[model samples]
Target: MTTKNVRPKFLNLFRIHLPVTGVVSFAHRVSGAVLVLSLPVVVFLFALSLHSEQGFERVSEILQCGWVRLLSLLVLWALFSHLFSGVRFLLLDLDIGMRLAAARASAWLVLALAALVLIALLMGVLL
Candidate 1:
């Protein structure tokens, strides 16, 4: 008798469906990485904005570019996503929202809150 192979030959990430909690957890990690990687640029821009009149003007001009504004929005979204998800994780550590339903609800809530923040940021920037 021969046995058939039980393992998948290839993994397809796009076909995988993750629960809301899993999505939130994954987003938290990704956002954290985004924030960490962007820190140097953020600090440099901040310092430049404070250096002198020319530096301030240069920083402003850099930020005025369309792509730069889009990147800023992305970075801001990452910031809020990391923050809200972190808080949800902390509460989970304390035994809150441990039930399946509650966990899913909280995950959706985190995503919604992050989205709301992004909207607010967009309005603030555009107006």
Candidate 2:
């Protein structure tokens, strides 16, 4: 008797998985959009605080909260990831990282760079 073949149950198991570069590329665009939308509100608050000393002090106080600091660091991470990934994309467009290993290595590098930027920002080393 012949037996019928069964397909894999996992949706992704039979599919070719996207490499890390693909993931980073997709994340870069998403992060960039988040940054773009946030820019307006951030600048508005920034400008408002600059209008007077009291406004400045008020904004400063708001920024002093731990939650606010954490949010700012998260924003910084998104911005950093977008910036680094954009550069990676540009390099890829220039025919760089064409090999599988190179692409994976570059993706890891971008993640590392983003982490470094976030750490530095948290340490108050970069604004």
Candidate 3:
């Protein structure tokens, strides 16, 4: 008699748990993608703003909308997340924080720092 296969044929992503480091690494990749994708739009907006007084005012008006401000905040958060996580990754490459505990702590620190930067930016913008 042969034993039956017990392996799952499909993955349930929602049921899978990742460590803090894993989450931070994944966020790093996602944030990088977001920043890359947003670059063209940012360049276009910049060029438009420089075209003339009308163009500058139009860009300003578009940026002043509540939804646009929220989106800008998200992009800003992505930028910080990518920057902090990148530095963490570079430190990891240098064998700093190679231990499991240190790695985990660094991962948490990266996340916390990025969030703190976002919060500070929001406060500065709103106040």
Specify the poorest-scoring 10-residue window by lDDT in model 2. 8-17
Regions of model 3 farther than 4 Å from truth: 1-6
Error of 1 at 11 (Å): 1.1
Worst 10 residues of 1 by lDDT: 117-126
**For every model shown, what is its TM-score relative to the native structure?**
0.94, 0.78, 0.93
For lDDT, the strongest prediction is 1
lDDT, candidate 1, 88-110, per-residue tens: 99999999999999999999999
lDDT for 38 (candidate 3): 88
Give one digit per residue, the lDDT tens place, for model 3 in 49-74: 99999999999999999998998988
Structure candidate 1, residue pairs in collision: none
What's model 2's lDDT at 54? 91
- Which parts of model 2 are misplaced by more than 4 Å? 1-18, 125-127
Tens-digit lDDT track of model 2 for 32-90: 88898779878977997999999899889988888877777777888999989889889
**What does the lDDT read for residue 94 in candidate 1?**
100
Determine which window of 10 residues in candidate 3 has minimal summed lDDT. Answer: 68-77
lDDT of each prediction vs. the true structure? 0.97, 0.85, 0.95
Per-candidate clashes, comma-separated: 0, 0, 0
